[model samples]
Target chain A: MYPTKYHKPASIEDAIAALGGGDDAMVLAGGQTLLATMKQHLASPSDLVDIRAIEGLSGIAVRGGSLTIGAATTHAEVAGSGDVREQCAALAALASGIGDPAVRNMGTIGGSIANNDPAADYPAALLALGATIITNKREIAADDFFTGLFTTALDEGEIIVAVNVSAPTKAAYAKFDQPASRFALVGVFVANGASGVRVAVTGAGEDGVFRHAGLEAALSADWSGSAVDGVDVAADGLMSDMHAGADYRANLIKVMAKRAVSASA
Target chain B: MTKVNMNVNGKAVSGDVPDETLLSQFLRETLRLTGTHIGCDTSQCGACVVHVNGQAVKSCSTLAVSLDGADVMTIEGLANGELHPMQAAFNDNHGLQCGFCTPGMIMSGVDMVARYKAEGKDLTSDAIRAELEGNICRCTGYHNIVKSIEDAAAKM
Candidate 1:
């Protein structure tokens, strides 16, 4: 990896100032993806703004039927937090299932969502649960937040302060995990939240994480495993990889949708 | 060079390292503690697992500078002249074959078991398998590795 400047700010304001100064800087969250990309020489930023030291950026809070997870909160913390488990069991389960024990313990929610890897599990949950991403600039809805593959609505100087996800009536996440890296081959998150029935699928679609409107409509009418049995997600733009074909992914979407509904029940 | 301060094995140590210096490189090079191995530069491999603030994290994916003032525990810090309980269990259960992935496996397993015990929950094979899903072991096929974690949990 090429040498670069490392700045550890005493506060979030200082970090923001460092970022605002016109330099190609990458906010070092968990470094799970960023560091790997750097080592591969895919991304050579001029500076790294270490954000781990910023106090109050790591926590889980539940109030008024809303669960707010701090940006820097590790996946392990989300999985282990009684507040998260009690409120959003699907989110906790998703966090617990991400990568392995080490990855879960170290990787942060902010980093995971910001990276927005096609196969990442959190994106599915966030979208299905109608989570709001509270960044330094503004709060963006989950649907609007994720623009495209590996793309978020965040500006260059913006930082994710926390994610405010409303509690759902019933929700569950299911994934066909890839063998080697444990990333999702086709992960589905099903939720009947205050915003109504929502279904989000990750890893299977070529467009990255997306909502299955047909499945959502079917399940919204009748929230049951069998409700999703005959619904076929279009394979037109689904991913075809060594692990699974596009048709296979489309089929798995229905299966996972059913399983998610069943699991939540 | 970036000047950073970190606590390793309960010792406060400060050093100057390259800005791009990985936590694994810092441990092995600057600190001269080579117990943590880097199997893959990518975060996919758990060969460089370590505890940052008592939680297991892939050290190779982290920067030495990012760990300033943070507590770290490597495989070298797991024991003092004697094998850690998890290490002993792995030996007795034949958890390691090539031994290349042992340190990471042990580090991750220690955190899992400790967390399980703290939660007052019983550790099962399924749970251990789920927990060890991140650490890759090409040799043992994970049968004995899972058993070792269970045995260690029982002893604890």
Candidate 2:
């Protein structure tokens, strides 16, 4: 059974205080993934700090060609926001396509990225868009933020306040979704050469979501589907599961990168 | 336990609830609003669907403490005594059989229709079906659910 004392903090300071109380405290944002994990007894926190009520923590804003999204902003808001749909259609599309409606409505970008499910979609967008995760303490680049499967650079007691993404000139995400779960079997996000064509692959990597340097380099040369053609990805660190093998995932990296490049073009 | 205060169906309600208590449990157990059902403990199932601040959310995945100062609208509050247009259409189009999933399905359906109406866009069957994908029903195969939402669109 889930064990926790629910605490609603009026401020970020209070929320952090709860986290530092020497208990296994989990920060609850949308709780779309966290609660489900709790229900399955995958996690048993001594305290749950609910931060949704904390003011000034949920919104979307575009300033100076950078999109600053509050950590608590739900997927539904991101997908349906007028600014997001117009300025970053690819991001909106990715948000809209994440799990079914309930998940979209309750799942936040911070929670999803923090959970770092191998098949999640946000990590690709974060890596490709060159987003900076703003926490209570500091800002970390997306490249350095994600460490491994279900791990991040975030230290305990640090809460993600917002995500600031330097808007891409053009971008697109394409994913081969697992039918039942709707999680990506192979998801790819490609941005234009302004950022030198960063390509982040999810669902196929053993490390959860990671940038494909080879594909990025190839696409930097030519921003087209043919750029990554015949360029094989190394299967050394690809995930092998009931869904697909390591070699198949490696192959899919190339295919998905090519498709993303073409779609963005 | 946490003391929670929120607007439910446009009325303010306050109560003390446990941190481990899901919004679904609060609505069904404490408040005794049984319209919202819990089909799965996981967030994957939308049987416990409810409107938290005007958006359809999985009640099972949310905590009452998180919604302390938010606005919530459950399936119980969808209509004013009489059935909403979506409810009427669901009945007319045979949108349900087992009826276990009807409450959640109808709540999501009405929310989608309201959202589209606010945007001044006509609701299409595809759009309605896409939004309702969060809600699942074991019966009717979703054939009539789609038809009911479409029919409800016209009536609205």
Candidate 3:
């Protein structure tokens, strides 16, 4: 690991200032991924603006018809928050299932979405639930927030303030675990929210998390598990490795989607 | 170097170390608290689990500088005058083989029991196993580990 400077800013402005010029400066939220990446020498940031301790950056609240999870809020908080459970139990469940207990205790929703790991569970839920990522600079819809594998619309020095979502009428996430890593082999998030029915898949896509228009249309029309059974999921652009072939992943997509619809219903 | 302060193991401790120093490195090297073992430092193996403020977090992956002015409780802090209930339970149940992962397993077990009890949720054996997902015993000695957690849950 390379020696770098660390700053624990008291406010968002201080954090952004600490992330000066932002090319090699990174905001350290939870540090679950960033610190580990640094240890492996895969990332050598010039400075890390520690955001988890910032007063307003860690919380869970439900106001009006929305649930806003602060960017620095840990996964354990989301998994255990009564407000989160009441507003979106599926989101809580998804948070609870990420990594192991220690990982959840340190990993944050902001960090999770920012890294945008291909097998991560948050992107699918955020996309299917139509979440709005509230950042210090601007608000980006989940649809536009995620661009591709390990990529997002975020620019340097842009700190994610919170993730806001309108409480869904019905929502559930079904994921097939990769076992060793506990990452999703093929996960599906099904929801009936403000945007009507939206279905998203994670872990299987070569381009990262993606919304399934076909499954969404089917679920919007029929709203049942059996409605997803006949949907054809092509393996053309999916991920294939020693863990699972793209063809197998395509089949699991439908299976998990059906399970998600069944759970949500 | 980064100057950090913390109340570790019920004592006020501070250090000036490299900015990139991990919590596990600080505990083992600077503080000479080798009980918090580091296995698979990539954050997969939970051998370095410790309590930051109150929750269990992987020390191997957590930066020491980020925890300035925080309270850190490690396996060494678990027992005050006598053995902690979880440690005793691990002993009674023979929950370890190589014992390299024992500190983390015990820390995670204690935290899991506290959380479940606070939530008014039952600490079933299945729940214990699920909660231990982060801490891996490469020896695959999970059966007794689960039993130890259940036993400690009852005693705690």
Clashes of each: 0, 0, 0
What DockQ, on C-alphas, does every prediction get?
0.81, 0.73, 0.87
The sequence of per-residue lDDT tens digits that candidate 2 reaches over residues A41-82 is 999989888787788789999987778889899898999988
Tens-digit lDDT string for candidate 1 (B93-151): 99999999999999989998998888888888998888777788888699999999999
Error in Å for residue A78 of model 1 = 0.9
Task: Candidate 2: list runs displaced more than 4 Å.
Answer: B10-12
For model 2 the local lDDT of residue A153 reads 95
Question: lDDT order of candidates, best first?
Answer: 3, 1, 2
Give lDDT tens digits, candidate 2, residues B1-156. Answer: 678898888888888887688898888888888999988666665788888878888888887877778899998787888998988999999999989888888888878888889989878778887787778888779889999999988887
Error of 1 at A222 (Å): 0.6
The predicted structure with the larger DockQ, 2 or 3, is 3
Please list the C-alpha lDDT of all candidates, in the order they appear.
0.88, 0.85, 0.92
* Superposition TM-score, candidate 2 onto the true structure: 0.95
Chain A only: give the TM-score of model 1. 0.97
Clashing pairs in 3: none
TM-score of chain A of 3: 0.97
Worst 10 residues of 2 chain A by lDDT: A190-199
Model 3 Cα lDDT, one tens digit per residue, B44-69? 88989999999899999888888888
